[model samples]
Target: MSDDVTAWLLGDQLNPTLDVLADADRVLLIEAHGFADRRPYHAHKLTLVFSAMRHFRDDLRNRGHDVTYLKRDSFGDALGAFLADRPETTLRLMCPASHGAAERLEALVDEHGGHLDLVENECFLTTPADWREWTGEHEPGRTYRQEHWYRHARRETGILMDGDEPIGGEWNYDEYNQETPPEGWRPPETPRFEPDALTRETHEWVTDRFDTWGTDDLDGFAWPTTRADALDALEDFIERRLPAFGRYQDALVAGEPFLAHSLCSPAINLGLLHPMEAIEAVEAAYAERGVDPGAFDPAGDGTGVGGTGDTTATTLAAFGGDESSADTDTTLPPVPLNAAEGFIRQVLGWREFMRHVYRETMPELARANQLDQARDLPPAYWDGETGMTCLSEAVGHVREYGYAHHIERLMVLSNFALLYGADPAELNEWFHLGFVDAYHWVTTPNVVAMGSFGTDVLSSKPYASSGNYVNRMSDYCSDCPYTVSRTTGEGACPFNALYWDFLTENEEFLRGTGRMGLMYSHVDRKDDEEWEAIRERAATVRERAAAGDL
Candidate 1:
């Protein structure tokens, strides 16, 4: 191996990008056991990464690439061992997704190296350098909104562009995507990919080695672990689910885990699907001759977590197949505008925005606690043992699948935590460990910046909500033990009381923030006795949650 060029690949960097493998003679793929061991990473999350890495290694070898594979304690240990054997071999690396991971690799190179070359990661639509160029005048950590950046990206890339003006005379179609599921319509089933022999063995080994939070049953391991499989999943989503995805993007139904959503995030984040390639495919589908794009009044897509107006009723009425449109043909391409636009916004808009914000906030995001929340994350988050049907269902979904939709993450999980004053950093750590698609770059902006408001500058307002919102958006509250309608007395929903308590507690900090004036006005109207009652009830809820009895 003397003087041989080898690319050191991380789990996420599984693609055969030219920078990593086009001219490289050898590749080094490491399974860092110590990395997974330290975090409360879900069993399935571990399985997905490991299985994908193993498969990518096999694929490269089959294509005549010399590959060195190591299942070792840590990245540091793996690099140490590899370098000890081949001191003269040149080690090249793609820049890692996280700042911490990049720093760790740099430290490894300093300790033991012949020559180390850092290559730019090519999985994302925009590079860090591109991000710098995009936000040239603004300093890092400034309060720049995603809508502003999204508009710029639309013009720059010409995605959904019809000349200088956007298609349908607007940049976004989010108004049509935020709706409740139609009463009789059902969502397409999320396709599942079973594990092969290699995946099975690696999964069993991971299940035995680490005490992760999610389900240990390998039979449920159906995530795409190879590039071919990931592509298949993407195609399946476009054909079977994309038509319905926009209408009910935010709605939640009981016993329906993958309702009209593209479950491609894990694959995309893992480099099995390139961002531009995926976005282009979705756009191509929209432009397909047979499909008619749906349209509504043109407006800019609002901040994902804090969309400007209350679109609850209008969106719900529209997507739920309002009595008139129910009979009309939605089957044919002048207009399926909502589905395509909703997806484009998620992929090209929100996804890119999150990464951009992450690049700016990096090392600081790890320690952010803007809300000054001091309480510990409750046991229910890891164990799926909550009494509230919404929380229980969301937690159980995570335990079984290692993932939940954004609505579940934002509304049920983070909303509850925000109400209870759970530490944002602790919640962020939980997000990092628990999901299959979560990496520091993804989770920091999502969980901290969007979900919990742990760190700010992305979302304009806290996404805190009462049970009323859940009742309207989901079916979970229908079977809940607590009454979704009540805010006081016996059998009141915990979220109702907790929501009021949170507003009262954070009123000082929330006073000047733009979207919170009406909420504070509501808080001010509550009598002292009513405020005391809400606080007292919220304390009970927190106490019960702490003891794992709720």
Candidate 2:
């Protein structure tokens, strides 16, 4: 109650020794009403963040820190309630990182008339000022390249290095990661931690308080909340799951949700584990077991995609999770082991680069119309009632698990959504609402910047698709009611026709793009008879979705 009280310790600032918590007195953690109500965020996401925050508060208490956890609907007015109850307290604050958060706290700071320090949230590797310096010089704005930036971070942080040279004789081994599992390949089962009483209590609180936030069937929800459980989950993945992860990382099989995925994103994002430590542990385990250095070895004796070795590193790298956590100066030695490297590239490289782009250009960036797309999202997106076997099955799984792998998300689900002309915003919202680990900072850049960014914010192209693209990547089409080869009428996969129409309609916006050049040539290769039937059927598919028929 004295004048030295620390004002607001935000939910997101869970990392100790960060600017927000350093040398604080009586840290006040707010469980606010207004911010949670600002948008229709998913109910499970609310549960995830809040439950994690409460567990963190208990941890701070156990560490002997004086903390007051408050839930208030009114901002400045609520300050009076705390002030009256504790007359000797002066507000000392570490300002919030979000624009909405900063603006709200600024009001409280002014009203309280005390010393408030705006500090850096050291959760990210690059600060806002660091990104601004790099971005200020480019024109028409250059997209952030994940590998180039990642290499720079590697050098600066001294990760994966051996005497100023990268370990493994290369900076990357993405070439080896792309081999698909042989037909009838069975992925090892993934680890799932059951929810304890604490998680259940948190779920009940979320349901009662934020009832209208968003909806999902929550019966199968088992995510790690405490630091202890998170560590167990990480160890389980390293020992039982990491080896086979590279091969099936992109694979889609019916009734299987966590094929080779670490499923640790929620824990890492919520500040339960550090990226550097997790990556190092994985590398150490592999080395200890003498995992065949060539297990994921991208350079084959001779065979694979484009005759270019194998490009699978993107799959493995994705697990370091997002870089905007309390990451350390540790990296697994460069594996160049195909799938592993590709996976890491996505998580550490592409993921971090997108965060830089989003922070530097959001609000305006969020509104950009890369493809000039405008259409209502289809009913099946929420209803989970689509006639297509793959889509219906995928959506239903997402509804139940609040999780899906990257390939399932970008290539399968988002691919079909784009083919159907589903509104970009709608898809973005749906993903954010349904996924357990979803956060605006993460999902916005992923959906808006990567999946839908025809302007190439993070991607060089829009990731548009035809059914053939799906068929090659997954076995889903094998059991579906439609054929990938059909271009029109009933029994054709809708993706085949809609793909051409999307390219035809957007030719003016996309023709000059080098990637689109290939798709355009493919479209032109279709004979007159084939093209006419496609036009008619594509039109019907669009009309049906627009009218809420399918």
Candidate 3:
């Protein structure tokens, strides 16, 4: 709490209003370059982080605070130079989300003869103590349920809660969140922030100085780099996209990349906007829209129609009185219970749960490979040269923009990798380098655990699936070169054969796991000839994938 203490801010901890900065008038920021050389990160990721850090420094200086900004190759050199003149200076920083970051930073500060104080990171909604209180004792290899933790978070924080129960009388509206968009449906325009002088300069620097992956087109750069722009993006999402976000949250379209998905992850992950700020903004929008929870029937069959009286009428009327009609009506309906609940669950439930799970299960989780599949990732993942429409589109999106919707991440990109028998750790590295929102903490659990089923600590089973799931949830199969109906022989969808082959290959490890009986039942029904054909097709697919000829 000393007034003489200097506050050191990481690139991700760009929020100026944090309590850790209140007592210190002098701020230190370092734009380190050594980390970028460690991997070929996306150009947009480097641009956004450095530009946001520069902007935060200016914002603080303009507010009458003395700031010392350093451009160095490493943090050690930066700290050494900063502490050369002022030895034993106390440097305060928020605890970073990555594992062992605080200890590493503290050790660097000690090496430089400076004192370091780690404060709670306010960018997230939950605390380490909150994670501890919810999960009383950590048992090794025990999986924690996200639903139970989600409810616990709601009860503890009173977010989207009516006294003790959830506001909608249901814990989740996942059933109503799977519908695909109607024919000729177009999503709302994604808001893009035109780069200002600083961003353009930073973009140029990132392009010249680093050998980065992904597209280097500044014209298509849309991520926000300032607090004000992040707020605008948040407002834009709530106003224009949130209404239909739930119904089509899981759907994948041919040309539509940002379908009702909030592009707030990069900004939130960068600390330009706090997680609570987004959750509260969404909660406020739902309250102001005056949606009646009674209109949503929990017993109805997933669809937000027919069982409810006026709800169906109102929803249909908003879309020109036909469920399949593609009329572009400007009149926005009240925010659906499913949309509101779903968005809240993402920020409050799943995001928080991922963080806590990573915190508790790391070191081992980072290297966990329960399935032990060790095939190299296909070249198509890097080059986007696949004939399969789903994988091609998903990888192309990541190659063009450092962004893709959660479904594309889970079902398309990671699902393909999981089915194809790619190593979980290698896939994790690909995600970490390719995405703007991905951090070690974020991608480790998602790609390794949830996506690859490397460990059952986060999920019960692998997210492996054949073309049927993709065909049902998306329109990719309609235009794909491979046939969805055919499981073997020529021009068969790769997912079908790989999926069955994966299940058959790993039945001993997966058959007894949670909720996998149905999948195994299908596995049980295949005869010797069918299995032989599937094995042949799967082998062919792997060979083709490895040769980059698929």
Candidate 4:
């Protein structure tokens, strides 16, 4: 390591413990405003990034590192000024997850007579080599399933594993993770971190300088901006929410936005907290509680040892007495095998899977449009003007907090867009701008390949569904003005007609897809007159959606 070397850190690469920064005593951080002008990003997203960067800079300087923090209009301007002063300076950076970012940064540095070195990004648990070994000469652009990769990761990391078998004797607990909350149930309170003076100043600056989207109210801002705050948030989630997280991970309720969800994605994705930190926390919590994974019977309904629905009582009784009456000191609630496995699968499985998929399939993946959907996203998405309860609730969450759980993103927001035939690229842009957790690597594969079915690289068929799916997974339909049963005519749910219409419109492509045969069977049972009515209703829904009057 040369004394002349300076580490250039991107906004997302805010972790102080990254290996790339260990040898460098000098650092450069740029807060360029030009990129924010490219899209109308959420005020919270902008504030979180900039405030985190500023705080990281202050922290580095406090540790006796030389820090050059630039607030310029563009990276070029900032680099040009830095390089003009120290021509031929050497810079080091972690390879960014966004495609072509490393090459572009190298070019910019080279243009200014500087040498650049790229290092492995330590934010992720797995490496490019891990992906390569997992794929093992598989053809690119083919479907890569998450389950298989998830199993491989667990085996490699020895997470929740007993010898060669999974702890629960199952690779997936998704079937057990879909239960909605019982009546009168309320989720644990969402943890909030009050903004410090520095964050408040950053928020004010962002509101003043940028034409941002989403709610402008700083009172609703709740993301963690520092490593300490992130660690606290992670601990809070592991203690209070992880127990019930898997049971209702997919459930949607009106006016309840953060139901047992970790809310750690913003921190982890921003590098304030590393992925392993979160994963290990959950694993350690499960281990310290002394819950035996072998006690869970995959053949049972997951309510208890033999489907009796008294998992806590059974486990406690096995230890000596009933949990309520036992003399032993009360520990935190035992983490259900379903909950532990489900949350781990997200970080160790799906999150890693999304990153690698986006890496291998970018540029074309950004432009992929296999479904040929070209309609602009409806006004409901932007303005939250729809009478559909699911759409309104999900959009309202995004507008207020730049956040929504995975189910709301997939089942509510993206599901409706896919049913209505909205363009995948436009939807991806909306996700990128609206979510604090969303980066190019996170949103591209989720919105384009999985959500919009723009490509079959990650999924074989679209995640298209009718109001019935929503009605089953959420309570949104109960209070909704539209009828869940009707497929056409007045007051009929827009999703019902649009879903069938989508299938019929893209039948040539969708009918042949895997797992689509069952849906097409229903499609075949409809009479010509019924399809005609569905088409008419779908057309009316599209018209209303476009006009923002739905």
Q: Global lDDT of each model?
A: 0.79, 0.65, 0.86, 0.86
Tell me the spans in candidate 1 whose CA falls farther than 4 Å from its real position: 1-3, 137-141, 289-335
Best first by TM-score, ranked: 4, 3, 1, 2
TM of each candidate vs. truth: 0.90, 0.84, 0.93, 0.94
Which stretch of 10 consecutive residues in model 1 shows the poorest summed lDDT? 297-306
| lDDT (tens digit, per residue) of candidate 3 on 405-456 | 8999999899989989999999999999988899998899899999998998
lDDT, candidate 2, residue 96? 43
Worst 10 residues of 4 by lDDT: 297-306
For model 4, residues 1-550, the per-residue Cα lDDT tens digits are: 3357888999998888888888785899998999898878999999999999999999888888899999899888899999898775688888899999889888888888777888888889998888988897646577788998999999999998989998868888788788777655666677889999999999998999899999997889989899889999999888767777877889997778998889999999989999999999998877765354433222233332223533456556555657777433234456677778889999999999999999888788999999899999998888898898989999999999999999999988999999888999999999999999999998999999999999999888889889998899888898899999999998999999999999999999988789999999999999999999999999999999999999
lDDT of 4: 0.86
